[model samples]
Target: MQLLPDSWPPARRWVQVALINLVVAALLGALMRYIFLWEVPGVEYRNIMHAHSHGAMLGWVYLVLFTGYVLLAGPARRVYTYLFWATQLTVVAIFVLFALQGYSASSIAATSLHVLLSYVAVALLWPDLRRRLAGTVALPYLLAGLGSIVLSTLGLWALGIIMSSKPPNMTLFYLAIQFFLHGQLNGWFMFGTLGLVVAYFEKQQLPLNRPRLRQAFILLLCSLLPTYGLAVAWAERHPAIYAVTALGVLLQLLGVVQWLRAVWPALQQLTARLAPLLRGLWAFGIGSLAFKALVHAAVAVPYVAVMSFTVRNFVIGFVHLVTLGATTLTLLALLHGQGLLSLRGRVARLGAWLLLAGFVLTEMLLFLQGLMLWLDWSFIPSYHTVLLLATLLLPAGALLLALRAARAPASTDPGAQPLPQYAAHSPVSANGSADTAANR
Candidate 1:
């Protein structure tokens, strides 16, 4: 029996590798949480954190986005395949080096190499993107996301300069780090993922309010530039900066509304037909995006902004809200929708739900802790112990997902088929429900 169907997306290996990285990252995260509750000798919290964050960002999220690009690029390019492996190697180097030595020269070099690799990818892929995506709705979003990827490197460069400064400007260093994080989370991850989603719609011949989508894109792009202020507001404590960030937040709110308008119709028609598990994934992903926007709006309030930056719990919660809640869920849903990872099995469903539950439970605890601290309320009893227990679910779930993908069988679903072959499958029916018989 073939382990994978011949028709599977060319990015199949990429997805498999990415899932393994996700598991590694989740394990690291759980380990960190565990350290908070008990003495784990030889494990430095900061080092583990560096490893976890880098692994999650580059190993899992970045690779998945790269998979999306490959899926959209039509035919496989040798360069893309080379870049994927090269990036994977670099990600492994960074994760291991950081875990062992926490931001030494070697790890920094590896990190820089990853940045350089991305720049090279943009250069190599630009022509194809321009040619293939020119007339599509995904064009602007993908291009903008790529641009953001490049733009974020400026922060890293600044960080290098600051760290090498005579007195080592800690303030500038922190700001630079925040700038990079904001760019990746809000700019590249959000836009790139949405680009992939919109590209799927176009490919499926789904009905979309094109004009509204364009409008939303413009607003979101414009807003994304200034919202860096929100990341820096507490450190700078400037009224003018806060004012600008507030405007950006408001624009983002409006953009989300317009975005919902643009996609809601198609989503309404498609979601009802989605498999139950996939539908739950979609709801969690989409709901997280809306919730993220609302949270940003709240941070526009100076008090809330300051509190968010100061409270460690709030910071962790917000980061996870975007990374795990929005990006990861959406990617998984898209993966399932594409039929790359079948959700029909009990093992798959259990893994997905466990991951979702872990995210929800941890996020609630984090935000609640933040709130209690802000209001001078009592801390949750045995918070660290409870959090560690919840955190364990993430890795457990991730392991199952990786195993499921590893054992996935070949199929003819759109996800399993090459881009050109998708037209051969009549997936949707007259009533807007997916033709389960045909798809399955």
Candidate 2:
């Protein structure tokens, strides 16, 4: 919509750009896998890795979150438009600079600038959101998500200090990195997505078990800080750390149980009306989150913790379980639910299937390799080639998604109809236009 300045892209463009960014990041990942199978000249593994991780984190996830906030929060201020573009510029800079120079000064500065931009966004938007969402289910999780974002920066600062030290304390350096990663991925990303889900339920007037929801929220919130111990236990394996991590893991597992109890009834009813693809995505996303909790619980075991951290494959597999399985899948479902993603299009449906298949295959390969290593078995034959082939599906899927989003007109599917509640509460219309009266 022309909700922003004429020079800026519309709200729909924000979503398309975010999807395109995912395509680019996935392509970079495919390239990395390719390099593993056969050495590619002038392509540095570590440097390209920096590009892929940062791009996926900031470009796809963060931007989508930003878009969700802006779209759902109603008519945004001009400042938000400025902030969005500024953040996007910095994300691009980080990807490019990191690809070329790893963590050189330019890349570092760009990364730091993106963080600062987020702070500025939070400062401007948080109070308004709090007031608007007061007494609502989404408020607490959104507040905690923002708070976690700030808290994670402490780890980044600590990391800088650790790295700058003469003959840097390598242990603390890794610990600091884990601290930041845990907070950002587990705290901010997971919590923020939960908040968005609750907000969606509210907007759609879906049934919810409030008491169970509150119980889940409390347990999950309480576990967030202590769970940092679980992330760092690999670096420091004291009994005290394990004890705290065990408690966190237990709390988190209970939280997941409560969460499922609270939402599954409504979710079952909701998905029943959706197309097959959308329905599958919803189930897959929620199921992945539940599985993630189980994975975290397993890490509480001393032997499992030791093996998980010792094996790089395990670490990567776990990260993907969170990022691609839980976070990305849920985000895609949300987008489709909101009419931001057009599954009626053949290309989009094909893309969704391909992406899901790729994620499943690659995850199997990764954890299977980790299991073989844990059991003192030989490597899988042609692991690199098979993994590369699987990885290629991800970029191909993402590329198709991006292309479909770019070419298809926004929400133009005549066969698609929103639920009654959506028409009543939705802030924007189907044609990339904000509803001034409805938003107000």
RMSD of each: 4.2, 3.7
- Which one wins on lDDT? 1
Error of model 1, residue 54, in angstroms: 1.1
lDDT of 1 by residue, 169-206 (tens): 88889889988898899998989888877877676556
What lDDT score belongs to each candidate, Candidate 1 first?
0.81, 0.79
Q: TM-score of each candidate?
A: 0.92, 0.92
Over 338-397, each residue of candidate 2 has an lDDT whose tens digit, in order, gives 656666788988999889889989999999999999999999999999999998899898
What's the CA RMSD of model 1 in angstroms?
A: 4.2
What ranges in model 2 sit over 4 Å off? 1-9, 406-428, 431-440
